[model samples]
Target: MLIKTFSYTSLFLSFLLVMTGCKDEDYALPVPKSELQNDAIKRTLGPNLVGLDIEFAYAMAILPEKGKIVSAQVEASIAGATGTYLEHRSYYTNGSGEDVGVEVAAPSTTTGATSSVTFNRDTSAATLRYFYRIPEEARGKTVSFTFSAKSSNGESVSYAMGPYTITNMDMKLDMVATDAAACYISIEDMAIYTAAEAAANPGKIDLVYLHRTPTGLTFNHALVSPAADPQYLPGVTLPAGVNRSTKVNKVWNLRDFHLARLQYGVYIDDVDFQELNLEGAPNFAINVRAEAGVWAETADGRYRAYIYVNKVNNGAKNATISMKRYTMP
Candidate 1:
């Protein structure tokens, strides 16, 4: 993974442009005065065709101060398709919080993709759940989101959601149950395992860790190395799907049978950005990239692991990694 940096001067100029854009009446008065609440759209990601992770985040700067939001819902429809709606499989998590699986809502026609999906909480607890599978027709197409937030006093607001482009990246992986404790291995150990070793210890190994090489490999090292081997720091293999990168840029993707590493954090909890925070703070810096917060289940349906790439050193051909292990219930 590569990391990109910017100058403070440019950042300051960007801030000024944003402030200038907000001076208009249409931006200032879209919501009612009675509900003087403000929302900061953190980000909107996927119609992830692979993991089915279609997530959007926004913070209610004033909702808690004003009053509780009585009705909070998200509605998404295919662009230019009129009535065609997609379904949502719901999961909930707060901030960089726990991955609490599935949220069951009262059976309602409105909650389906075609209709507005109402949420239980209103104040910044709105993470898109992956309950509805993306139809084959909707893959690789653009889908729009509409967020409706209403206060108890009948002051309601509708936000014209983003026109996010869906990608065919694979997020689903074969997870397996393991009893091993948290551990770290050098890149040489990971890639150099012999064929006999892999077969001799079937299911013994599950997670492929990535980090900055203790010795460190440079960007040039990556360019010269062939397939994901010890000579060249390998990219994580993302879960199986059309979303997998067709062109191997030495950077890896998440695959069910394979995993990639990003130089994101030194410890498991310290990763720079969530696996979902791709667009916001992009993990890569200079020639290195760091991404953590990847969750997946085992192949036999026995175990799951929350894998994080603490950091990857391209110059030295090494990386550091961490993971949280869970036995599926």
Candidate 2:
């Protein structure tokens, strides 16, 4: 009977208050989703060069309870020399860093656009890998990637990774020279042996020397250890026209790997010779025969080289060695 006299608005307001009081409230609201910190994110570029299959891996942590990561994207911007820039095609990957199996549209190659792209993504963590063919325009230019991740709860996060620079040094092989008396021959110098210099003398043979000619590559594999005494011309020569396919099961003894017939008890296998290619260098295939990749470190280890043997001319007593030098960041 008393309810009959109550106003409809008043009754509705009282009912709303009662309903609100019936349910429990959460004092702590969910925090906003967070992107991985810069320090926590790991970025790696595998052999950066133009017109080559270069791999990029970004590993990050995704905090638990931040909602499952649903999707990830990358925006790449290439910087031009004149202070201008061009936008590359966006690449998408799963959380594991693998490429999704869809074709992505790429711009013209002359504009620093890569043709082939692949990557992988981790479903749990924020790990991603991108395998791309480096474009010619990207050489000597800096390219940056901005990554974004979205969550199931409609929350999105982003991280900026690198302004990784592509260099011509990798493609343009340099010729260098070091004294034959030097104890160690660094690949950092990007040295190639010339026909003019030969470490045949006693003092000259006591140290390590590298000679790279168009026909062959010569180095002292005998004195590899610091403590080991420099033996008589304990060097190995990789002759031109020797490739993995043609020179299989071949044994490289003193005659095959050395300039003269000097032996220091070191032997090399044909299988040990590995071949490498400069991403976009056409001359890579020219006159290069038996080649392999060798890494030589500096004394302080601040500098290093990823070297490739381009040619070996044993008759001419010279070898051609090409390299890409890197400094510790």
Candidate 3:
């Protein structure tokens, strides 16, 4: 009986030891030294196209006791276009979810591939935005950025951003095409030409825009190739040398935001143009409505284009259009 009692006592002690070992313990994080720090993020989405802004937010911070920000700069791998700039203002979100900006530095200055902004206010932390307008030289190429910040206490920090690729497709927006005037479109030049202009560059004319109200038919806004059938080109005469047999196919409900600038979030990238198959497609698109579009290919098969109808003015017999063109190899 004494032996059994001793065994029970030993088991009770082992249970107590196990409970003590499972007790929670206090912990603390290691403190880091105060220093200048910077981070960057790309804010723009979709294909980085030429003539559009590639936006980034550069955030820099230092402990209040450390020092004030001296200056900030961004160096692009390839020089941006003339309009590229770094905003000197810092933005913060307000209660209404709107971004409110405050001036924390003087206006920025750009030289070559570098843009710099110097702080004028007493600020230890700020988030600045940089807008790099993709240049013609950067087309079909990759570009990167180095964002840096310097503090008054002789400390500096830099953050590197992506080598983003620029799309080869070209975009032109808000072009007006009036019936029988400025109606000829050239995908090579990406512009609308009048009858005289089309006559001068007849070979470049690919598509013709017209608004006709023919009897027994509903052809309000139409995009007809220069070589389309006579029935589709009612009351119209083709300019001399404008006889390319271009191909066109109509599409509905494709409101690409980049082209239509509408509420829809759809986008057309390079692959869309590459994968587009226009074999056996029609040469004319009739009764085109706002937000509607067409897929077109030049006669020589050198360029493929997407023409988007932004708006149509039936009373004025005109339409606002935009285009995205891709050059085929």
Candidate 4:
């Protein structure tokens, strides 16, 4: 009996030891070796449009004991526009949560598709920003970037970012549409035409703008298709071939920042145009107010557009408009 009790006690002790030893493994923080390392992050949001900047933050780090950062460079798949550049400063966040920039390099230089900066500071770590202005040639295409950094110790590191797609939409801003001759808008040409011009190119006229203070009615501002009813068109005479039936739908409170150029952060991307439904929509937007907009589609289904009314002058009978147009498949 004594021997059996001793055997049972030993078995229980072994079980306890096994349970104590079966804990999860300990996690170790990664420590960089004596070499340079690089990482890149895209900071710009929304659709990549033409004539706008695509921003990136590139960080390169090495132990001060190892070596100092010598230079950094970014190579784009396609050459950017004239305003493309790399910042010569390194940035860090302050206690107030604001970014503080410190000079770390001379002005960057660009040659062909690459922009580079040579570090003038003796620091071993830095985060630089690169702004690539989307060129006209990069529209409707994909662009990628390779970010590289070198150290005084002859070690180099590189990081790759995106093959981000550039949008195909066209944008025009601050077009004046008046109650007089310059009231005809052509989405294909992205221009406002006079009465004679509309008559000359009747097929290009998509929408007509007019302001009427008719008695006992509130038709302050309106946009009507050429083939709209006479009541919506007021006193205007349509050109001979300006009878295409356009589709229009009015919307409110959707303030697109790109079109409105206002404080709102809203953006209308390519997907909005692709997913817009104008089936059985009307051909006229009456009493349109400032900050309101409309979705319009051409009669032949070749183009889709969003027209934003930036401002309307009731006394002068004019409006400032902006548009974003997309071509249909």
Q: Considering every candidate listed, which one attains the maximal lDDT?
A: 3
TM-score of 2: 0.33
Regions more than 4 Å wrong, model 4: 1-34, 95-97, 239-241, 263-265
- Candidate 2 versus truth, CA RMSD in Å, comes to 20.3
Query: What do the candidate models score in CA lDDT, each in turn?
Result: 0.37, 0.39, 0.94, 0.92
Q: Residue-wise lDDT of candidate 2 within 1-329, one digit each (tens)?
A: 55765777688899999999899866898874364422114233333556544444444344655545455554567522221221122335789997554322232222232222222222335445444455667866777766555655566566675667665433325232232332333333434333233232221111133333422443322213222322323343322321111101111222222212133333222112222222232111112233443443334434434444445544544444444555543
**Which 10 residues in a row give candidate 1 its minimum summed lDDT?**
241-250
Clashes of 2: 34
Model 1: per-residue lDDT, tens digit, 1-329?
12234576678889999999888664454564444343425232322342343445432223455665444455668422232322233345668896554432333244445444444444422333322344555655667666565655556666665565554333323222111112111121222222244344434433333333334544321111112243333443322220111111222333221233223222222122123222232111223244433443333444434443445555444444443443433
* Residue pairs in candidate 3 whose N, alpha carbon or C atoms collide under 3 angstroms: none
Tell me the tens digit of each residue's lDDT in model 3 across 1-329: 99999999999999999999999888889875699999999998889999999999999999889999999999999999999999999998999999989999999999999999999999999999999999999999999999999999999999999899999999999999999899999999999999999999999999999999978899999999888898999988998888988899999999888997778878899999999999999888999999898999999999999999999999999999999999997
Top-TM-score structure, candidate number: 3
| TM-score of decoy 1 | 0.34
Scanning candidate 4 in windows of ten residues, the lowest lDDT window is: 31-40
Reference-based TM-score of each model: 0.34, 0.33, 0.89, 0.84
Ranking by lDDT: 3, 4, 2, 1
By the lDDT metric, which is better: model 1 or model 4?
Answer: 4
Candidate 1's error at 209, in angstroms? Answer: 21
Residue 301, model 3: Cα distance from true site in angstroms: 0.6
